[model samples]
Target chain A: MAKILIVDDDEDFVSAVNLLLKSNGFDVAIANSRQEGMEIFDKDNPDLVLLDVMMDEPDDGFVMAQSLKKKAKNIPILMLTNVGQVTGMDFDKDSEMVPVDDFEQKPIMPNILLEKINQLLGK
Target chain B: MQIIDRQKVNEQIRDLKKKYGDDRSALMPILQDLQEIYEYLPDVVMQETAHSLGIHPVEVEGVASFYSFLRTKEKQGKYVIRLCRTISCDLAGKSNVARQLENEMGIKFGETTKDGKFTLEYTNCLGMCDRGPALMINDRLFAKVDPEKASQIIADCRRDFLKSDFPKVVPSDVKKAGPILDHDLKPAEAIKKALSMSRSEIINTIRESGLKGRGGAGFPTAVKWQLAGAAKGKNKYVVCNADEGEPGTFKDRMLLYEHTDFLLDGMTIGAYAIGASKGFIYLRGEYLYMKKYLEEALENRRSEHLLGKNILGKDGFNFDIRIRMGAGAYVCGEETALIESLEGYRGEPRNRPPFPVDTGFQGNPTIVNNVETFIDSALIIVKGSEWFNIHGTEKSKGMKIFSISGDCERPGIYEFPFGIKVSELLKEVGGEDTKAVQIGGASGHCISQKDFNRTIAFEDIGSGGSIIVFGPDTDMLQVARNFLEFFVEESCGQCTPCRDGNPKLLGGIEMLENGRCSFTYLNELKKLCETIQNASKCGLGQSSPNAFLSIVDNFKPEILGRVPEAD
Candidate 1:
């Protein structure tokens, strides 16, 4: 089983994602804020990360993605956010500002999320 | 006989440090209190303050010299009379009042009377542009002062019988009120409703309302709240930018008075959404008269458990607010500069990228919204986005409060929706025959007659809600000169283009007045305006040349080829 870390402040969304990952045979760990997310990543060493952009800070997910890339280049980051909808600030994956393996909007369809995860994890 | 009690002064300084805290941020209030005691800040007193605050004496001196309100070398007269010298007042014959004051005082402007009874000085806008030739004597405001009234005021001040001449609170004339202004929303009701909703839900509601900043900038308010909420800080802050020093802008003065509760409600709601435990209302020194009224309002909120810790029975949710006074620096109206003033530093704009949301006061996340913006958001919380959104256009949602002045007959506060046209506004305000209109303040565009059809929206001629109408007889060149002079005086002088280029533009206007300006040189000056706009570090500098450029471009036929006057 590929271990996955779900980092978001929205409890309901986090809970739903946690169940989806677990039932699909992926082990899941949860962290609510950017600081907590980093600590959990170090401790758990998850295979993949489910990141949120606006948590305790607006760009926490992007900052975390950069840090994660620096720490473990092999591990993939899948950004799940409502930042574009919320802020109206158009952004996409770029190596410098928004560094991530793949980006998807929040309330992501379960099958699409699993397919993206499998592709990043080389399933 | 000015007596200096060294021991007593030292003890008082120690007490002030305790009252305000021992950090560098406490320097401004402590100095203000000391100035109140001794009339002027003596070197010995400033040195003692430096020692108490644990900052250097030169650092204290730097701050004292920066603000016009803080005096150092000499004692101010018992009455420090600051007469408004900005555009609207200038148009309202402030010079006549200025001459009358000088004749009555037996001293020129900036000089204190020998007996220390009175001092005359020129200040920027006093937020009374509608009633021009207004002057502030100590903490009291006197508006519509004619030559006769000016002399009488001087006599009254001398006899110490000016008590009955002024009202306790200044009255604002609201000529027209829209749904935003005349709503039946009570005090703290929005806050009560905000408390019921989740934090994200509150932010989402604001985002849905399309509420941009009302402080002239029109930046989206929801983005600011969301960013501040997500920002990593031990403490976060929600600041009410009550520094309404924009030359022709005074709607905030009315909002602070008329919509006091709604303003407080919005601020409390902002604090809750951003997770800010503390907030500050950075009130301008010009609006010193409104301070006590606001302080009392804050006290009411605290007593009712609407403001202070664990508000309304919510555990671990605690928030409080304080009022900080700006010492007559117009640039302090800028968000970062206001934060600097709140931190006891000179009101200079800081470089961007690490914006206020990510890093602000005391290196914490902070949101500084205009007074009207806060009230609008709070109203959104109570009434929902649709109630606020039904009126305005697509991009610019909700109504805006305008402080209309200059040649307009009905000069007062008017609330209009976002997409109202200039011509429509003129007809409503009885300024249909007006030659041009200076939309926004000194930093905004001076619109011509042809562009009256342009709507007041983010997509068009956006305003911070200051409308100055120009009559047919009005001198466009003089109008440009007045705005340039305002920028020259009010610029923080941190950047070269703003500090140097503004005076250069003012000199060019003088040449135009004398008809000595050449066509090639005129074009050169126009380029300089663009350079100043592009090169300056902050908004003040960038927008300083706006009025001048607009007038030069719009009224070319009238401005060019002037006959040489008799020297």
Candidate 2:
């Protein structure tokens, strides 16, 4: 089972994600802030990172994703953004995407999230 | 005060080299100190700069003269007032504002006051279009100002300068004083000089003066002239890249208006420099006034025997300039695309190697330069290399003109020494509440508070002068996305990456707008943006992603979203 690190500000969400991954028979680590996420990433050396769009800081997720990629070039970064008009998602294209591996909208359905992660990791 | 000779200036440069380590690194700052001491960079100053920098003086000259912000010639003024006349400011009524300043100061746009208190000029957008009606007194900015307010500001500056015991001889306005072509010369005189000059002499004069192409690439003007001349074409042509496609840059338009003859003269001179008999100006279709001005000026020049064959009773050098208006296509600004547009094809960039200097325009040699670059040639010929060499540092030989716009107390075009500190520029032009300044125009980079220390020089900033300021409330992400939207709409749909990639990136912004995008989708958008920047074939495709990168890097939260905890 590949170990995954999920970085977000919400503790409850991290726990829920951990439980969901554990039931799927995968090793999972959680970080609640960018600093903690970086530490966890260094310690666990996870195969992938599921990053939240907004944390304690705005765009903290993008910054964390950049940091993660800088640390490990091959490790895929799957970003998590909130869904709805309030966040404005209509402007993105496949070409304009950052150097990140993949992205998923919030209100994450388990099947879609799993599919995206699997596809990114080429599992 | 003595006009410092070349050897003495070189010694000062040498001392500065010991004080500051890398001469190339110290290029702008050294020029700044030199300009402070000498008011403008003379040819000797350039020689000194090269000696101090341990590089070819031509390199220093190239960098200095390419930018519009640096001033090299002498001016009889205590103050230089630059007004923003770019499209955005035009929409915001800059003409009236400029006229007001002219009337109140009792000096035309390039003329110093009889009392030697002020010189006035108008320039393109300085990037603060959102605030509109911008003006610069040296490096200081005043934005959202009306005619009356501008009058008050100028009056106050003059009064303050006059009263001060420690008056800096060049007026507090020297920092804002760019090349003032405020002189009114007959259109025929301007055309006659350009028509009479020999190709090699023209090239050599420009070479000695160290002028660089102003159309984004910063190529040496003299080298391009030489190449185009030697291209062995039976029918060679010269082109003025007046398709001013950059979003926030409007210096060319100002050049078209204030010095109409100056530009035509430069083109004629360029034609002579490159051994070309025919010339075309591919002006952006949007500049209705510029088209009218050039057409009338061309007519006037023709009437005076300056444009026709063997005019000056010599070996019959025949040349004429015509205007070809563009139909709202941004890509036409690119050299190859411009050639394509002129040839009645879709404006798309052609691969290089057989550059336009050789195989261009109907399979003949062609040379293209921005309007400002060509205008400087007239001054270069009139003044000589020694005159052009004085204003900027060793690397950048002459003055650069910048269009200042955006949220500031006052904003407009500013001409100054090449190496003036960003902080000093902000202090000079940006009002007290200034937050950030965008260098290079809308498509240019957004310099945040952190990068304020970076000097505004050719080596650091990529292209010609355009400084746009922003205040506390400015939405950087929105501003950047707006820039992207411009690209999306303007893309000619010639290439897949530019056509498809532009819309896709724009779609990401849409997702952000709807607020429906998950953080994951936004991340995907970021990934795609990188591909566009790295993979695109043309400048539009490459730079289209710049605003997105700046937004993603600098204003992340605005584009990304927050997620609630799973309850």
Candidate 3:
């Protein structure tokens, strides 16, 4: 089973995702901020990362994603964002400035997200 | 601790301390060097820096987080594409440029590409307003870039990345016109003239010319010199504030480039007038290309007896200047923050009870004048106050250098007398089919067609010479939002009003843009901006809302496109 790191400030969302991933037989770890996320990422060396666009600040998640990509170039990342709703600017996943394999907007569909995770992890 | 070589890091830190001096003030430069070495400020490096500076780790961390340039992350890409998203560039269709880059590189504004080849990010301004839409790939600037050019630029970067050969892309040719003072004049001519006059006479000439600091704030140059000269201190210093970080303003760059010796001569003259032996030119980091030229000028001056050890061969008038580069902070352009950055601290603005004239650069009496101000002083001394005063209005005397860009046939530098109307300038710069004009970069006023009759004087509509004309199709609300986002990222976060208030204003602007804000909410935001203007610690915070307020005041109908619901 491939291990995945979920780095987000949304506790309820993280718990829900954690339960879903675990039920699907994937190893899961969680971090609430960029610093904490990096620490866990270093420790676990997760095969994939689920990053949020806004954490402590609006661009914190993006900054964190860049750092993570630097550390592990091949580790695929799926970005979580409500940027379109917040700023009325839609972020295209394929044309994102930050390096992210996919984007899952908030109020995520469990099946779609699982499919994306599987696609990114090459499972 | 484990990531870096301990001995090597210690040696580099030691070298930095020795070079910048052993004082705690060297902290900013030291941190900048460490960041250059490590790509970002790691926790271990911060701790070591604190230990080296003999300060607490929190202080180091606090300073590191305060500056926009200093990053604490480890994820910088090979080519960081800093696209200028300020008003001038925005009006010049920077959005299209951004979209093209995003589509080509497969990344959004803040994301690095998958191959670590590119990291697209938005920058406040690269001082190339006359060449917008401008973007910098690393420190190499690419100006006048359209959507097609942006794609080619990115492709060029990818090619360079693959080949490991990164050469600076030559900036597109910017046409120069109008009455630029002393463009072809020799270096030490003004200084020689000033050397013949009494110190008081030089100050009086500047006063008679009615010259003011051209760094946005129209404080009288003569009065500033008088204060510094009269201040009770033996170790007086003259600091030429070459840190021209104002968005859309690059007249200083032109001045420094074309007339390097003229600016240095002016600084030397300032040192003599103020009875100061030491002088420093705080150059901005973005214009690193100008550094070598300036250093070469300084070297020539030293050899010619125009700078060091009794400049111009006069005893008791010894003076010299040294260049100190800024490590990319917009707030450092503020006088107090510049002083703080000079002293090696985070470029945070200090409270103004003891102004820089009284307590500056090592707590000595110092005179901090802008690059244009120094050049104006030199010209005033040589040309006589009466001759210099003949050009401008009653209050705002002397010619001003304007960096005109966007929505024009010919965009570049133009020098005009202060009382010249906006329409007149528009004609000169080919500003046709104009809807609005943003004067003085992000933190200056936005004027509409009705205000074209307004004169460019301190008494009417003053500026630091950044005029960005927008055609009819340009969106005023989007322009305002672009400036607000600039303030959001560049705010030093020292005070509550600025730190918290700017982001709120940005959010409010977004809400309004999306038609989610009510009239009452807009009014509240206006009130909040007033508070921020009055209560913020420094000029950055105080003037941050100028464009927003001006846009709202002028284009209320546009901003209120949606009708307000009754409570």
CA-lDDT, candidates in order = 0.88, 0.67, 0.80
Residue B74 C-alpha lDDT in model 3? 55
Instruction: Report interface Cα RMSD per prediction.
Output: 10.0, 22.2, 23.4
Best-performing candidate as measured by DockQ: 1
> Largest lDDT belongs to which candidate?
1
| Candidate achieving higher lDDT, 1 or 3 | 1
**Clashes per candidate (backbone, < 3 Å):** 3, 99, 10
The local lDDT score (0 to 100) that residue B286 gets in candidate 1 is 88
What docking grade applies to model 1?
incorrect
| Every prediction: chain A TM-score | 0.97, 0.86, 0.92
lDDT of 2 by residue, B229-278 (tens): 64556688989998875756656656676667778777877776666788
- Cα lDDT tens digits for candidate 1, A1-123: 899999999999999989998999999999999889999999999999989997865666766886788789888999998765664444456664456889888778999999999999999
Rank the candidate models, highest lDDT first. Answer: 1, 3, 2
User: Among these predicted structures, which one has the highest TM-score?
Assistant: 1
- lDDT tens readout by residue for model 3, A10-108: 899999999999999999999999889999999999999999876765545655665676678789999987654654333444322345788777878
User: Which residue runs of candidate 3 sit more than 4 Å off their true CA positions?
Assistant: A1-123, B113-117, B159-184, B565-567
Collision pairs in model 1: A56-B230, A57-B230, A57-B231
Q: State the local distance difference test value for candidate 2.
A: 0.67
User: Where does model 2 exceed 4 Å of error?
Assistant: A1-123, B1-175, B180-198, B513-526, B556-567
For candidate 2 chain B, the 10 contiguous residues with the lowest summed lDDT are B165-174
Error of 3 at A86 (Å): 48
